[model samples]
Target: AQRVTQPEKLLSVFKGAPVELKCNYSYSGSPELFWYVQYSRQRLQLLLRHISRESIKGFTADLNKGETSFHLKKPFAQEEDSAMYYCALSRSPGGSYIPTFGRGTSLIVHP
Candidate 1:
């Protein structure tokens, strides 16, 4: 079984301040990590994937196998960046990939 955990249910930060959204996972086999964001009145979208190793909208997350963590970080957060962030874990077993999402973290960026 695979599980994703977002310890903080809500994160408040001021504009231009650094932001970190903690995410931890537990799985027996190698799994892929992804960060999804849902803005107000908008559908959920992919923010970043561990396999991509790229930054999107100034947010980046590195998969740490040693610690079983994939924490999302941004140097400067913006008001528009506020959204519901979710950590997801996916693994392909028997040729099927099943993804499990964490109880999303609501990011509130104050002006």
Candidate 2:
């Protein structure tokens, strides 16, 4: 069975601190890993993808096949980036990446 695990339900910290959102998954075949973020009152947008090897808004994620994890990391967290984050995965076909979102980790940035 394919499953996505996000250990933290909520993460809060002051601005300019480093942040790491952990994610682990279980899949038999090749999986497409993605990180989707949603700010307050904003639509969810793709933050990064393992396949793309791209980082957005100071966030980057890497897929570890051995550990079966795709954790998101950022050197510094900004107040503007504080939002709800979800780690997602898709099947090999890549036609319909119906993401199974984790419970979500709400990041609160205090001034």
Candidate 3:
């Protein structure tokens, strides 16, 4: 079974400060990792995926298979960046991949 953990339930930081949202996973087989964010009164959206190797909104996450981690990082955080972030893990059991999400971490960027 695959599991994703985002140890912190809430992460608070000031504007213009660096931000790092931790995400760790445990899976026996090859796993796919993704970061999703939901703003107030908005639907959840894909922030980034390990496979994409691309940064979104100045945030980037690299898959470290050795550590079984895919932590999201941003050089500097903005007030508008505050949102509910979720870490997800997916693996093919036989057919399609079913994703398991973390409890979620609320990021608060203070000005």
Candidate 4:
């Protein structure tokens, strides 16, 4: 079953708190994963990718094959970044782009 899973439906906490959004995936071939975020009515944008090994907006995600996870983490969450986060996986080749999205996690950074 090739799929992307985001376990938590809602994760609300105060600003400057540590945050982690869990993501898991199942794929047959080499897995390409990405994390997308939507900030309060804004369009969804790519946050980070496992292959790129980069962090965006103070967020980072790591791909775990054995555990089939790509969890998003941040040491100190900012109030402005409070938004909906989704874990996604792509099955297509060449890393061209197009990922299956999770239900999404709503992160509330309470000021």
- Reference-based lDDT, each prediction: 0.95, 0.89, 0.94, 0.87
Q: Pairing residues by index, what is the TM-score of model 3?
A: 0.96
> After superposition, which runs of candidate 1 have C-alpha atoms over 4 Å from their true positions?
93-95
Q: On residues 9-66, what C-alpha lDDT tens digit does candidate 2 reach at each position?
A: 9999888888999999998889988999999999999999899999888899889999
C-alpha root-mean-square deviation, each candidate: 1.1, 1.5, 1.2, 1.9
> How far does residue 67 in candidate 2 sit from its true spot (Å)?
1.0
- Residues 1-111, candidate 1, lDDT per residue (tens digit)? 789999999999999999999999999788888999999999999999999999999999999999999999999999999899999999955636888999999999999
Q: Which regions of candidate 4 are displaced past 4 Å?
A: 92-98
Sorted on lDDT, best first, the list reads 1, 3, 2, 4
TM of each candidate vs. truth: 0.96, 0.92, 0.96, 0.91
TM-score order of candidates, best first? 1, 3, 2, 4
True-structure Cα RMSD, model 2: 1.5
Q: What does the lDDT read for residue 75 in candidate 2?
A: 88
lDDT of 3: 0.94
Where is model 3 more than 4 Å wrong at Cα?
92-95
User: Between 1 and 2, whose lDDT is larger?
Assistant: 1
* Cα lDDT for residue 98, candidate 1: 82
Error of 2 at 111 (Å): 2.0
* 10 residues in a row with least lDDT, candidate 1: 90-99
